[model samples]
Target: MRSTTPRIDVVPAPTPAASLVFTTVLTHGPLTRIEISRRTALSSAAVTKAVRPLMAAGYLVEDADEEARPSLGRPATLVRVDGGRALFIGVKVTGDEIIAVLADLCCRIRVARHLPVTDRDPGAVLASISGLVQELLTEAEGFGVEVRGLGLAVSGDVDRAAGVVRYSPFLDWRDVPLVELASTVTGLPVTVDNDVRALTVAEQWFGAGAGISDFALVTVGAGIGCGLVVHGKVVSGAHGVAGEIGHLPIDPLGPPCHCGNTGCVEAIAGDAAIIRRVREATGAPVTDSAGALELAHQGDPGAREAYTRAGEAIGRAIGAVVNVLGPQRVIISGEGLAAYDLFAEQIRDAFTASAFGTAAQCDVMTRPLPFEEWARGAAATAIQSFIGIDTY
Candidate 1:
């Protein structure tokens, strides 16, 4: 029987080198073949061979080299991905909201949509995903490009190979076949992945981790999540759950975690933890992280203390990760960065105190990113699948 589900039958990358060459161009594009060779370490012949199919398929294009030197004879043409060749939809499902984006082949977001989550049930979240994907699909048609695939990034343990969300604490879901569900609903192949891991893929290829062989991404907000890239590859762990720094036990007697643990990083530094601490400390009846931040910004001692503790917890958690994985760079991001100022000092102090030996020298920086960036990460995952480069 013919399948009703839409699929991109074309394999954009027939070999691993093809995938590497395409993404290298996508990230650092408009480069001469020689430069592509230098960056990818692929021989000139291999680079040309890999790019041939991509350019033929309209996924790549060539243009006269802009950095050409007349004295150096004929200019070398540059290769770049054709962003208009295809479209992808990326969805980021948070505990309170769903953020979706329509992205081009280059993983550039063309349109973004958001919907508040009134329910966290698989069925309800699926409905929200359906609506947002439909909107993006409609938008894709206007671009005259096929929406090749859909990607879903959710928080928790996700088996990308199986497309199953093993357990999502934020959504209280377990054993859900998200890819199967989303593909059925959207009529497009769906790639399901851990939200933080998906974001790490984007960073590894196109953002801060670009060209860095080892790095870590730590997101602080609804949850304290860490994504690690070691030896130029995103590590998903043997059990499909790596870099779960959020569950690191910092305070055995600190607070109860959603995972039934005491004083895990998430229990101390997650948004809910901050909100709960603020309410208890200040008796302010703060219901959200914003309200908690407002009190802290107003110089409330109790609120300030809450942030101080949270920051220390986060810093200590990061220290543990660094001590173990020895990542070269650690990037801190997410909506919770809004509260960074309140406890920046505490985090620095704690991290410095906890880091062992040269690990303290590792660069640690923060970049404030909206949820849309995570959605874009989801889009990147779709692009990976389309190019047959996904870890799977």
Candidate 2:
């Protein structure tokens, strides 16, 4: 039997200035009012006005900073988001499993659950999603705060504005009205987004990309995905697909992609592609990524060569991103980083060879983000939508 969906009480809409102040503090706090004013470019009076209502709502709190006492005036009172005031739920749907997290208003994951997805059908996925959400809602009851919103992140082309999954190759889904369906079942306002973009949002606010206005996150795993942040905003192309580095045709005669293209980056470097190449190269019954990785670690020349080629392909894609966008930094992430040791040299070599002269100077770094982080990213999107940010 299904549990009754909880009623959602919408938060009071904050003014533009108030929203800005709140986000600034949420990302970089506990800041003094003067510091918040300086960071947000709002005047002291404006910051005060913004802070007053948020504090009154119990969303923000002030703490006296005795150590920062000024000789001429009173000690500074630092303001920060009261994370315990509310809760949120975030879920990331992969082809084979679902990752869910219960997060505080600050987007901190208080609890996480993972469930294997045996069925790809929309109805089955929705049922699993609702079950996980109900579990989280029960968890939120312990904190005595409302679960304000739910966020869902999936891979492939997603129209966030329309709340639809236009095409998700992994799940073999198209035109699924995810937001409406999930919202109806979970009884909470929902935000739907591409998985990579959702992760970029979390990075922008709380991770490595924080404070960096221009950067790109390149995720290498089952698929090669790129998320771009330009001018302090995550750029969702006008047509809803941007930064698709995986589809770049680096080799015209290369392997065929699921997207019906030849020589696409993903066709050459994605996990399945790598596994196929490894099996063909070494004549090993390498059925999965782990098996292929094991062969490479065992010094199998063909398996090692496969990883090298994948690294080269990935590097070329990164070079393309750098030459075009000229971002200050490029963050290499995803589950594929487990094999970083096998292809680190090839990736660096190919990137240096393909990058334009000045573009070669772009800083490239790797960070391995767990599945839980991806779920947290989904939560961040919900927070963005709740705060009236341009999540779409």
Candidate 3:
């Protein structure tokens, strides 16, 4: 009897140069062959070779730019990725909700969905993800394209190579084989990565970090997370845990962290920490981040103090990252940005106080990325895996 399992089709790039060429075009295209070569640092001949197969595969398309044509030369032709060539799904598993996006080969989000996750059990999360993927797959049918892959992004220690989520404190999960389980249920090639790192991939390719060689993405919300890009590559430490700025112990006498550390950045600055502090300080029935934020905005001294402290912790954490890596820029994002007004001044002051001489020159800016963007980041990871890029 014949087997009934669906077979996943791997995209054909065939060489590192091909992958480079494709990425260059995807990120900075409708470019002429010469522009692609210049951007990728590949020889014109190599760019031509790479483009040939991709265009033949319908993954790339070329168009004549009559207006861009030089009077003395052949009409300038531009090459770009064919976004409709393939489809992908990206899911971001947060502490309380699941954000999923249906995207194309170019990583453009076609649709987004959010499902509140009341249960954090591994089985429940997997089932939610599988259902989301099926919905996305059905949506893909309308585009007449196959859903090529699925990407899952979770907070915490993720071993992308091993396809396992080693530890996810937010989800109270440890040693979970997420990729295998998700792939088995969805029947599509799956890529699993740390949520922040996955977001970094999207930033590196298309967001504020684009065209920058070294940058850091720091997220503040339920958790304080950092994603580092050095020499134009996302740094996944040998142990699959890098840019863990949240766990950096800043105050010896500070509050205890779930990671078994005292005065950690997250302990002082995360949403839970802020809420706890607000409740203790105000003696109010502050049950959630929203209530705490409202209290602060309403001139509650205790709540304002809590935000100030969190801001100080976050600033110091960014300073530590700048001191250590000297990235050109640090992009602060995540859901916690909702309270940026409450802590902006404190964060700046603390960062200035902690950063050493030249490191203080690093630019720090905030960009509020919705959960959909994070899901799209997950999709970007799947696209990277499909194109044989080093997402890890």
- Cα lDDT of candidate 1 equals 0.90
**Model 2 root mean square deviation, Cα atoms:** 1.6
- Models 1 onward score TM values of 0.96, 0.97, 0.97
lDDT tens readout by residue for model 3, 141-218? 898998888899999999999999999999999999998788778888889999999999999989999889899999
Candidate 2 lDDT by residue in tens digits, 57-129: 8889999999999897888899999999888899999999999999998999999999999999999999999
lDDT of 1 by residue, 263-334 (tens): 999999999999999999999889998899999999999999999999999999889989999999999998
User: Candidate 2: global Cα-lDDT?
Assistant: 0.91
Poorest 10 consecutive residues by lDDT, candidate 2: 1-10
Model 3: ten consecutive residues of lowest lDDT: 1-10
Go through the candidates in order and give each one's C-alpha lDDT.
0.90, 0.91, 0.92
Error of 3 at 327 (Å): 0.8
Better of 1 and 3 by TM-score: 3
Summed over model 3, clashes come to 0
